[model samples]
Target: MSRLDDIIELIQTTNEVYFITAPGRVRTAYILVDDIIELSLKVFLQEKVYEQRVNCQIDLESASLVTSRNHKDSLRRYFEEKLNIDELSNELGRGTTGVPILQNHLVSFPLIRHWSANDPNARHTFDRVIDDVKPFFALPTTAPVGTPPNPATNLLDEALIRHKTRNKFYHDQNLSGLDINDEKCLSALCAMFDLVDHLFPTFSDEVKSKHTVRCQIGVLRLKQTASLGHRELSQPYEAALQLLKKGHKYDFERRSVEHSLVHTVSDRFFGSLREQFKNTIAKLQVRINKIDTMARPKQDHIDEKNDKEKLIQILQKQLDQINALLGAP
Candidate 1:
């Protein structure tokens, strides 16, 4: 099997991996760190047993994947800010109340949906909704210096934005559409994933041990919840351009060194114009041999002299051109 396939198989043995997919062929994979999974599992099993022992007040729909209730407020706001009610309502065949209520219940659930609110004013407050969902957004506030944010995180966040923006674009009749498959965008995401994998080896190690399934299924789930778009991938492209510029500068410097050697031979080593002129004469003699070999009978001394003179003139012109090309400091 391929490396990724092997990883997928290994992750299947553990419950920490999942894949997600969405519109525009968007795909994402995620793996819960082993420690985090262990912690969450302990809480999950305890809670699961408690529900079985008691007449639970909470409906199955209200169950959330996040073990902690502290993230609830942030999650609520994220859905509000992200959903375009009018368009989402149209797509989901549900009224405005359906969206917020479902979002509330999804605290433990990871369902992707076209959410909306009953109040027209609340529905119109797109920015407010975004503010609410900021907690759910995946932009990292801290990373090691010189390191970009996690690739999976970046992709997940962009997917969220595009997911939210898609309804707005459609409602506003905007022509712009999401482009998830953009080459640069994909490259940036791939790089980010690679970086994340490098720093946190657990993801790959788990897969190698067959303790993780296709954790990519989680990203696929997220994608179905979100959307993708075609705009620029931003920082990655700029970084690449900067690298190219540095390479160009190095090449120019190397060529300048070669030009200096040519100048050393013609101007410095030859010293006086008389000696340089004699060297040119010697070069002319070598070229004359080739010309005479091509002739029916070797040309007379006059012909040879004329060829030598012409060669000297040509060399003088080339030297001038080279000097011009390598302008004075």
Candidate 2:
């Protein structure tokens, strides 16, 4: 299964477990949810960085630097050094030790800043949530020494509370002064879903489309055979063509299909077709030679020879078609 599949399954299973487990285990559920969220964000950011690198949007030196770090660290470095956005990078300097620091910083990072720069609503959404999210990354000491932690100031604060609660349960093996209940679990889930919705709004559709393309490619490969005759070969060829057509319908970017067709399938298919044509030509030449050797070739023999010539012509036409498809010289 793909990494995206694993992450989606993790989220779904954790949600189910949270609903069924006893209240005592709800903290564990929350921790599991947090871990899944962290994993998902890391995967998403790493893929984004990879896409940028492949597109030549990231310089070689910066790409080399980011690749050296772990995924989370790579994300932090990319945002800072590559994108020149210090939002996620600044979180690294915070004194917090055990918490997943990258995930903490993600709440306030201007993830949509570049993509939504022209849209005021997107900018406004980030501005409204920024202050609420900032406190989650603040050092514990920054809170009052004796005063009870203030009630969650916003959804971001609520997520932070769930994170801290889970951290306490992990380290202390106890949930002292913490409440683990359906409401808390639901709240954490909502905050996580919200973050996911904002950060990867198109994630589900992208996954579905990719899976469809992958399956179509698999079917094309399976339909192909070593001994495919000219007619038989068309099935797989047309299947591949259909796959490319469907992919173009969904994703207008043709680079991937073009690359696969030209670099992968075309080369192998051209070689196979050329070899088949050569073999057919050689066999036809042999039959024509035998027909010539017949001192008094019968009418039936003549007709058979004519049929062989027609077959040779048909094979030549098929070779031409193959060459056209491959854009071969």
Top-TM-score candidate index: 2
lDDT of 1 by residue, 60-122 (tens): 214432223433333333444554534433334445665675445444533222232323223
The TM-scores of all predictions, comma-separated, are 0.20, 0.33
Report the lDDT of model 1 for residue 30.
20
Candidate 2, 222-256: lDDT as tens digits? 22222233354444345445544543332333334
- Measured by lDDT, the strongest candidate is 2
Q: Where is model 2 more than 4 Å wrong at Cα?
A: 23-25, 57-158, 172-179, 204-329
Q: Against the correct fold, how does model 1 do in TM-score?
A: 0.20
Candidate 1 minimal-lDDT segment of 10 residues = 211-220
Against the correct fold, how does model 2 do in TM-score?
A: 0.33
In order, how many clashes per candidate? Answer: 41, 0
